[model samples]
Target: MTDILIRNIDDDDLRHIDALAAELGISRSELLRRETKDLARRHALQQVTLDDIRRSVDLAQGVLDEDLMKQAWG
Candidate 1:
């Protein structure tokens, strides 16, 4: 794998990462890798949810507006 450098990390953030790494019994780099993967996965899931919402909105657009209002008020 290629090496990536992350710069400008705050001291407090670094300390937090270090603490988590110690707690997890892993190196800081390993902890960072795991966290990054988790973040990416969550982001992908959110995108999928947003896409589903968009599709629902688009489908609703074709439905009768009066029906929607009646449903909303009822």
Candidate 2:
């Protein structure tokens, strides 16, 4: 596997990474590797901000409802 080094990481940023790794019960390197891969995969997708999501959801307002319940359940 290729190695990537992130330089000049701030103390707080490192602390956050350490905390996240502890939370996930993994080494910081492992957590960073998994996160990096996930980010790489996600980077290829269309990026949507919170505003975009809100707008899309607003556009879809009241669209999904109990209408499909009959077909799904009965």
Candidate 3:
């Protein structure tokens, strides 16, 4: 496996990372690895386009009425 080195992290952020790692009963490296994987997965999932939105709307076959908008806002 490839290793990663992050430099110049703030002391406070390092403390925060340690705290989170402690909370989850894992080492700081493991916490960072898990978080980095989740971040990459979410970034990959966010690749949407106008055509994708149009296709989703077409598949839904639903209208965006005021009631639906109000519910969404709430």
Candidate 4:
């Protein structure tokens, strides 16, 4: 496994992490690792949702344009 060093964390934030770690019965390092992984997972899921929305918009636009063309010709 690779090692990572983070610097300049706020005192309040460190305190919060310590409290959460104690509640979960885990070390601060483990809590940070889990939180980081969760954040990455959520960000990836959000990107997938955005892509789906873009595809839906493109599909809807095509359908709307086809309907408009038919109405104009009819």
Which runs of model 3 end up more than 4 angstroms from their true locations? 49-54, 61-74
lDDT by residue (1-74, candidate 4, tens digit) is: 68899999999999999999999999999999999999989997776577798888887774657778798688
What's the TM-score of every candidate structure?
Answer: 0.62, 0.58, 0.70, 0.62
Q: How displaced is residue 26 in candidate 3, in Å?
A: 0.3
lDDT of 2 by residue, 1-74 (tens): 99878889999999999999999999999999998889988996667799889999997865566776556577
Candidate 3's TM-score reads: 0.70
By summed lDDT, which 10 consecutive residues of candidate 2 come out lowest? 62-71
Q: List the global CA lDDT of all models.
A: 0.88, 0.87, 0.91, 0.88
Candidate 2, superposed: residue stretches over 4 Å from native: 47-74
| Residue-level error in angstroms, candidate 4, position 43 | 0.7
Better of 1 and 4 by TM-score: 4
How many times do residue backbones clash in model 2?
0
Candidate 3 collision pairs: none
| Alpha carbon lDDT at 70, candidate 1 | 83
Error of 4 at 21 (Å): 0.3
Q: Considering only N, C-alpha and C atoms within 3 Å, which residue pairs clash in candidate 1?
A: none
Model 1 lDDT tens row, 3-68: 789999999999999999999999999999998899989997776577798989997893678878
Cα-lDDT of candidate 1 = 0.88
**Model number with the top TM-score:** 3
Arrange candidates by TM-score, highest first: which order? 3, 4, 1, 2
